[model samples]
Structure formats: structure tokens, C-alpha cells
Target: MWLPLLVKRLNQVDMQKKGLQLTAEEIYDINNASLKDAIVQFGGFCTGEFISKEGLLLTNHHCGYDAIAARSTPQADYLTNGFWAASRDKELSNPGLFVDILVRMEDVTGKVLEGINAQTPEAERAKLVSERMKALAAEAKGPENYVTYVRDFFAGNEFYLFVYERYNDVRLVGTPPNAIGKFGGDTDNWMWPRQTGDFSMFRVYADANNKPAAYSPNNKPYQPKKHLPINIGGVEEGDFSMVFGFPGRTQRFMTSEGLKLAVETSNPARVKLRGKRLEILKADMDKSDAVRLKYASEYASVSNYWKYFQGQNAGVKRMKTVEGKVENEAKYNQWASADANRKAMYGNVLADINKGYADQKEYTLSQVYLGEAALAPAAAKFALNFVPLQKALKENKADDIKKATDAIKEASKEYFEGFNVPTDEKLFAAMYQMYYNDVPKSQHPDIFKTVETKYKGNWNKFAAEAYKKTFLTSPEKLNAFLAKPSLKTLENDLIFKTVNSVYNNYLTNINPKLQAARSSMDKATRLYIAGLREMQSDKVFYPDANSTLRLSYGSVKDYEPRDGVHYSYYTTAQGILEKEDPKDEEFIVPQKLIDLIKAKDFGRYADKNGELPVNFITDNDITGGNSGSPVINGRGELIGLAFDGNWEAMSGDLVYDKDYKRCINVDARYVLFVIDKFAGAGHLVNEMTLVTTPSPNASTASTSAEAAKADVLENVKPAVDSKTKVKIKKEERKAKAKMKK
Candidate 1:
């Protein structure tokens, strides 16, 4: 059986138990309209779902952070106070944001595997597969707006083609204050028992005919074929749930040596480097509101992965991830040795992998340090721009120089907006020192020699002198220099010379060694993966995730992380107040939220216990690109938004541990509560079609009215106060009118 059949069986059992009464076709059917149409790739980076027929979309707050940051100012701190579009006309337009919806997918394995297989050389096989994919993709192309690409699966043993349509005009609808949406910040990120709302709302607009178009005032909200109906019924333990989205990557088939490199070197280096960088940025941000708003997105982006790396390394060691891979390798080797044909096909896989790691480790570490050190300094990074200017100056064309200079002038405003010279100087000194000490002397970049000779190995003095002399540090000075456009000045520039010295050495010395080692490792991996599939012929193996649309299913269940520590499946708003600290930037609780919680003003969004549910956890397998994926019950009704993974499962991207792996999701009720009660955006709520339950399966649902009423009654209702009761009644009446199809 294929992976789809296994998933179907899992869903079939789940639906029967949870009263969802849904079939596979309802979730993913090419012949009929299905729930798949409602899910779209948000901003080409995260997953999102359509909530309203008018294209009101829901995604995680962090997914929309960059756009929100772009629209933010100190005077109008949307990041801090929250934002609500009083009406569609008032919603802010996000210029570079867009959504992609998968039109369809088809297996192209037969076409991709036309050439000689076992006998063909690895390089030849790759070329043949690539050519076939390109040809198939070309044949599938239909319209200018639609995109097509082919993906490799099961280690190039399988291939599939996917077609998608793009929607460009996505606009901000509403968002909760950072204190609510990003409640626990880095401290609580990836840790369970969380209270973060972690949700955001946007709307997609199309042309008059409801076709994709550029942003225009006259565009209307996209009328989608299917939009998920919001189920007010909260989830319970062992309830059937599934997540459909684009998971970025998962190296499930990596060898032991690779895991060792990550645990020993890569993870620690990244965490240390980002820690210093974040400290520098946070200091400046705390001192000024202007700096805070300006660097908010950048700081968040850096810290998110910084913490992830730390947890990942710890998890790797705790779980003995490398040992597990070694065991798998041993099994593969045993299987290979038992048969002559198998041995011939995969004999040298393990030795080649080990050799590659041995050869590539030192260079890889050097490359990582170079990125964290030389590239970490703002002045050093900005200096690379002058290389293009230098090339243009050599051309001696007026237009070329003008174009290059104008580009630099245009980029200056944004470059300097969040930058603090003194903060970056400190970062430069620290990072430079770390780089010098971490990497072996032979692998050290040539610039370190200059530092040792000129400044007597004092990174602080070198940093001070470099910043004082670099024109790139000040936008005004850079802009002035750009006007004259002198090549001689650029050649003599200290920052440029320093960067070029390191960069040129990396290109000439370090990169060649890395490439040769990586090539050997890749070839061995490809062969090993193919051999593994052959050995496990009785079972169907799915491909590793590569930023393609995939469906994963599981249930909402609590997990025991360690000895005597059984974490619950969900967290409540009460936890927010419990974790509150005014002095801490991460756990600062908003007074409005605090007052509401204290007064028990849950309105009509509280659970049966009269408490507001904040976040929940599930076993639905997901990764980076699945950040804003909708967590749907078996009936395909949206119940929550997946935002993070538990700290115990940070190594999941490399190896999925079902026992410890859990996806953290923002409960749908909490998201709506923040939008209506907290942000006071009732009109936005009116746009969605909220249902007590998803339409039951046609085959299993009872025809009697009594049975339908009983099913609806089984789902808990949110408590309504006098004011909230009236508001909900008005919304119910409106929904009833809209349902008159």
C-alpha cells in the first residue's frame, strides 16, 4: 500500500470514534471540491486557511511579522498596541506578500524513471531524471498566473509534479498586541503549557472577475471554492486531528556522522553567535522605542532559530539521535551483506559517508564561523555592496555608475533605520574574537592576520578603528561617497579590503574542499536511500519533506516529557497571568488582557469550564514552513493554528520521535476571542461562517433531525454574558440569513 492508503486508514478509524463522519474524498479529492482548496501557501513561506467565502484568511502572527514591521512606526505602534481594520477599506495593503494555492498534483514516477536504473551511473541517472521533470513540467504549464514544479521523493526513486495558482493582493485584516500574540516570546517558545494566542488575520483580494491581479483599490475579496467553517467545539484528548501544509525539510535519512557534526559543532556555534547578536540588538531596543519597533522583526527572526538550535542540540544528545542512525546503518549493512546483488548496489555507502564527513568537517566549521563573524558585522556586510560599484566603475559607463549609485542611495534609508553603530561595534568585537579562537589557525581568514599585526590581536581595538574608518557605517557618508563613485577610494576602503581578504580566501581555499567532500557524500546518500527502499520493499516509505504540500495526521494527546512530568494537551489564559512579569520584555502582560482575565470576562469564547483556552498540542507532524497551518478535526473543521513544536521534539526535523514530538497550536477559540473581545473587531467575526459542527459524512450521518440536534448538543457552547449574548444573537441571525442557499 502507498502512504495515502495508510493515511486513509488512520483517518477512517479516527472519524468513526470522534463523530466527525468524514471520508478521504472530503479532505483530498481531485475529482471533487475538497478541503484542500481552502489551504494556501501564505506569503510563499507559511501555511494559511480561508475562513470566509470572502477570502478572510487566518495564519500565525509570526508569519505576518515582517509585513507588520514594515507598516509599523513609533507613533503608531501596531506591534505593541495591536491593529484592527475598522472596515475592509481601512485594511493596510502588504506590498510584497502573496499566497499560493495548489491546483493539483500528479505522480510522474513512471516518466522520471524511464532510463537505466541500477546499472546507470549516479551522475547520468540524475541528468536523465532532471530532463524528464523539466519536460513534464513544461507540458503541464497552462497559464501565466499558474506555476509548475516537480519534486523528488524517496531519494529520487519517485517524482511528482505540482501545479499552483498565485494570489498577489493580500491585505492585513487584524492582529492582537505582541503581548498577546507573542506572549511568552523566546522564554516559552518550543516549551509546552504555553498561552500565546499566536494567530493573525488577513484577506486576499482579486480583480473584478475574481481573478489574480496586482493590488488595486477596486479589487474584491476572493470568492473561494471552499473555505473552512470555524468549529466552536474545542478538541479533547484522543480527538482526531490532521494538518495539511508545506513542511520545509526533514532529513529523516541522514547518516550518523552528519548528526554528530550538528550536535558537536554546528548547533553550539550558531547558538553562541546568535546569543551575542541578540544581546547587542536587545540592549539598543530596550533603550529606545524607535529602535525597538525598527529592529523588532529582525530580533525575533534571529532569536527564534537561536533558541531552536539550543533545544535541538540538547534533544539530540538526550535522545541519542546519532546512535539511532548508527543502528539503522547497521541494519542496512546487514541486509546488504546477505545478498550479492544488494551488496553490489550499496556496498560503499557507509564508508563514503564517513570519509566525506572526515574530509568536510573542518572546512564546514570554518565556513560557519566565517558567516557568524565576518558576515555578522553590519559594516562588513554592507561593504560587499561596493564590489558591484567597483565592477560598475571599471565599466566606465555613466548609466552603470548612476544605476549602481542610485541603488545604494535608495537602500540607505532601510539599512540605517534599525542600525545602531555602537551596538554593532560591540557585536563585531565579540564575534571576531570568537571566530579567531574557534576556528583553527590554518582555517582562519586572512583578515585575522591583519588584526594580529596591526592591532596586536585586540579585536576591540580593531573593531573600533574599522568602524571609525568605514564609510558604510553611516548612510549619509556612504551616499556622499556614492555621488563621486571613485574606484580608487573603494580599493583603499578598509572595510572592503577586510571583507575581500576573507571572502577571496574562502572562495579560493575553503569552498573547493567543501564542494569535493559534499559531492561524494551526496552520491553515497542517494545510493543508500535507494538501497534502503529496496530492502524495505514490503512497506511503503514516504519521501523526505522539501517545502512541498504534504498531509500529516494524528490525535490531540498529552505526553510525558521526562520522569514524573506529564504535560497537559492544552493551556489556558490563566497561565498567561501566572507567567506575567512587568520587568521582562518577553512575559509582559497587557493591562487590558489582565483586567479581562481578572474579571473573568471570557464573553462567548470560554470553554465549558468558563476559562479561555489559549493553546493546545497535537501529534500532527509539521516543521518550519507549516508554521501557520490550520489544525483541522477529522470532519475538516478548523480548530486551531499550528505555530511551534515542543522543546523535547526540536530534533524532529532530523528524526521524528512520535513519543516526544508534539505540534503546539493556538486554539481557534482563543484566536477569535482576541480578535473580538480583546481587539474589539466584531465586524471581522461577522465575515466568517462559524458552525457548531462540520457537515457530517453523508454515508454515516443520521437523517433524523433528533440525531443532528444530539450531535450539535454534544459539542460544548461558549458562555455568553448579557452583552455578549446579544452580540452573538445578532451574529447568529446574520449567519442564518447568509446560509439561505
Candidate 2:
């Protein structure tokens, strides 16, 4: 298997084998903008694509969910029923939402490495690299409006400069209700055989001249350099698939000890802490619609990774990931010990990793608990923002006091709108108790001492008193204090004191030791990665993802996650009906959707079998930030949107499981059907450059690989009855055998 390229460019031969017909220059031509221009970092967290020449954008429903929730009211709940602009005038403007397109990339390794080598001290080397990077980035940025930055690759063994153009005037076009967009919710997030629509529509607006500018009524749809042609005709199993976007991060080179610590310690801590937090949030959300609306986005954001951590812990344990890493280290040690030069360069790498993790074990747990516990109470976190006010009042700087007062007053509206003091008070007590029990007593902050002495270890009473006394607990109380704006008032506040004590102790005591240990690990990991790269010089080494544009391609095929249990490559609308339960919030199907299914009203978007495809799976490597990425086929046509990954490979960020890691995507046809039929937004559909579905025999993995030509797959799966399950297992065995041959 070939390693993916660090840059967005692909190996032509490998791409051709995967059915990609586009040349490397065609995919990423700096002189003539190409496919890369259509892909953008969607609001810094997710990926999105331009699907029409008119700059109509498509991303995951979850990506735009916050904006939708923010704009919604009880009388007109866009998140509950869905939102579709009847005309351009009705489209919603999203402030602070922007898309960043990669303008160009240049390898700047030689310039960055000008004064550093194997012998340079790590600190000195870092200083020199930082100086060089700033100069290069500034020089490249020039007088242009583009954003430019330098990124290190291969554990800082190489560097590249990237330039980007940002468009801020993005607007909401349409979305399906949460019932469809987040069908299975937390229950089916990382799990496969999904039936979620998981898509939303937006458009980029530009000034009359077609350049990025602030939102204005005069702004028109920006014409894009290139936009993907949406293929309503679906994909088949073994078809070529390519995912293009900014994958967040992958730690494929983590040491055995490092993997062990995350599996046993860190991941469990996050899962436990977040579980308690979600429990409190969910209970309140269930009771009131206003509370639900206020905490919807925050809950989704927290629970998404809360479940991921649970799956990752189970996956790593099941796969014996640490054991495999231990075996790999043993092999590397043998190779290192054989030569004196290799021994000097690489012998201590494993030991350093072991020691580093061991030294930071307690600190790592405390860090996670502190962040989750101390910050769990929204008012406590919000109170820290007034520190500047404290400083200003102490110094008697009237100007600074006025500025901080105004800032806090303005911010307090948004803060208190979503905040519920009673809910947070419960979370405050529960999380504090969990943290105190989990983390050793020596690591506890001074606040814990106060809890013991002042409240006699009665955390509920302590939390209640804290909430009652702090002016920050309510907008009314906080606003009254804002009118006076004095340092003495804030300094006497218990919330302010509690935040300071925990934060100051962590900074003064825990952080320095943790940083020192982590620094040693960083140095050891870099040297180990460099040694490994040299040992396998002929093997291709793709850099770890660092929120940069990258292209990964693979065949779309089914996998048997375990014996006698096989999942197919795709899911259909029928699956939704099968899973629907009126009593269950996660699986509730809208009556309109059920009627559409009953009428079989899929129109041209339906597959040959006359059913609407919902989600499909692929082997392309992806992570958190890759959500909403375009899942294009061989001819660079948009067939689906990459949204989630199968649960069996939740440890993928740390270890790439080629066989079990599947990129789950919502089929492009389903997106079209929802916009055209469900939302009655044909105008939005009209803007897209829709293409005819391909001939049934156009391509497959075997033919594409044989012909040296592919990008991805479309296969219909049989129903999961007892007999069909047996057949799937038999076919999976045959497929595995064929691969070996």
C-alpha cells in the first residue's frame, strides 16, 4: 500500500489505479485554480465545498447547527422544523462565520532548516525556526488581503507555507430538522449503518466585483473558480472515493507507553467527567424548551466527543493497540542496538517516552479533571473574564475601567441567555465531588481546602452558597455591579476567588512540571520519528494532519468488523423506518418524512432499486475537522459529504486502522431530495450544476486498478435478515481472500 502524500497532490499512478482521471496539476494548479479552490475550511472547524458556480456551499448539518439554533425562536424554530430561504431576501446572515480557501502552497523546508541540524540544542533550534517562520510568513503575505502561515510536517522535519483567501459573507440557505440531520444522535454517532441526512446548505456572498467583503444587502453570490458537479446517480461498492479537507490531527507515531496512558487514564477521565456534565444538561434540556434551545449546541459539542472517547477506549482495548506498539518498538530497538551510531541516536527514545508519561500521569489526570470540573460551572468560567476589570480598578485607571465595564456589560447578555444557575449549581457540586474523588488529595487546589473546612465537605451546600453569593450568577445581579464597576466588589466575590485559587494553583504548581515532562516527550518523539523515517527511507511518509488541506484516496469496500457480523457499504431510507421509535428522541422520524417514504416520492434522486440512499462508507482517512468534507468520485464529482466515521475505529486519531476505519457520508442524492422535495427549495437546486448519474458499468475497483485509472464506489446492500447476514459474512471472507492474492 502506498503512503498518502503530505501535500494535497497525489501520486498519479496510484490515483489512476483508484480511478482518478485528473492530473496532479489539475487537482492543485497554483497558476490556474482548480479543484482545491472549491474546498474551504468551513468556519475554522469543519470542511465545506462550493457546489455551484454561484458559490452555493454544502457542509454537514451539525456544522451550521449552532447558527440555526441561535437564529431560532419558539414561534419559528428553524432547528426543530427546518429552515429554507424562499428567496435571497429571506436568507439569514451569519456573523463571524467565514470560509477559508487555500490559495497556494510552497515547500519552505530549506529556508526553515537554515541554521539547525542534529546537533543544535532543541531550544535554540526552536528559536531559530520561529524567527525564520515569521519572516517567511510576513514576506509571503505581502500587501495582499490573503491569510498566510507556515506549518511543520513530519514532526517538524519539514515545513511548508500556505496562503488562503477568506470569504466572510456566508449565509444560511437551507437545512433539514434535527430529526433528519441528527437522526440517531449520540446513540448512533460513531456507529455505522447510518441513516442520517447530516447535510445543510449555505451560500457565499461577495461584493459586486466578486471579491470577499463584509455582509451587505448589495452583496451578490460570489462566482467560484470551480465548483463540484453533483452526481445524483449514486455509488457502488468497490468504487473509487477521495476525501479532500482539513483532517484535524492523527498521532500515528505515538509510542507504546503513550498509547497505554491515553487508553487507561486520559480517555477514561474525559468520558467520565463529560458523562456527568451531559447528564445534568440533558435532565434540564428535557424539562424545558427554552433550556433545550439554550444548551443544544453546547450539549452536542460536548457529547460528540464524549461518545468518541468511550468508543476510543473500547476500540483501543479490543484491538490491543498498545501491545502492537510494544511489538513495533521491540523491532525498532533491535535495529537500533545493532549499530553504535543508531544506538546513540535512537536508543533512548523509548525510555524517554516511558519516563515522560510516568512522570506526568497524575498531572495529566488532574489537568483533565480541573478543566472539566472547575470550568463546568458556566458562571465560574464567565467570572474570570472580569480579571482585567480587577486590574484596572486596583490601579485606578478610569479609562481601562470604563472599557472593561462596557465589554462585560455587552457580553453578559449572550452569557446569561444560555445560562441556568440551578442547572450549573447541580453540575458544580457533582463534578467537584467526582474530581475530588478521582484526583489525589495533594493535587487539590486551595478551594478544595475551603470546601472541607468551611462546608464540612458538604459539596452541595458549598456549591449552593457559591452560586448564591456570586453576582455573576445572574445578569440582573451582574448588571447592577457593572453600573458601579469597582475592584473591591469583584475581589470580595466568592466565584472570582474560587476561579482564581484553582487557576493560579494549576498555573503555579502543576503546569511547570507537566510542561517539563511533555517537553522531554516532544523531543524524544521527534527524534524517534526522524530515526524511523531514515530506517525506512524508501517508504512514503505522509505528515500527521495539522488542520491543513490534504487529499486522501481509497476504494469503497465493505469490511467484516468481527466474525459473523458484516456491514455493507451503504444504507437506505428504509433503515430509518426500521430504526424509528416514537418514544425515543434519537430515532423519532418526522411524519412528513414517513409520508414521503410511503409515497415513494424520491423522483430522479432515487437509486435504480427505487430507494433513497442515506449514508455510505469509505476507507479514506479522516478525523474531527474533516466533517462536512466533500466525498468526490473518480471524475471529481460530488457524490456525498463526509460526516462521521464508524465506531470500530474510534482510536483512528492515534492509530490508523485501515480495515475498520470507514468514512461515513450522506449520499448526494439524499441531499438533493431533501432540498427539492422536503424543503420545496428547487431554486437552491437550480443553482447547482447537476450531472447525469453514471452508467452502471462505468467503473469498479478491479477494472480501475487493472486499467491504471479511479476515485470511489456505489453498491446496493442486501437487507440484514438472518440469511442475508450469513451471505454477507461469506462474501467478506471471499473479499479478504482476493485481497491477499
Global Cα lDDT for candidate 2: 0.84
RMSD (Cα, Å) of model 1: 8.1
Q: Which is the leading candidate under lDDT? A: 2
lDDT of 1 by residue, 588-678 (tens): 8989889989888988778755788888898888899998999988777888999999888999888888799999999988988888888
Give the TM-score comparing model 1 with the true structure, all chains together.
0.89
Question: TM-score, each model?
Answer: 0.89, 0.93
Residue 426's C-alpha lDDT in candidate 2?
93
Runs off by more than 4 Å, candidate 2:
1-10, 695-741
lDDT computed for candidate 1: 0.81
- Best of the candidates, TM-score: 2
Cα-based lDDT at residue 398, candidate 2: 89
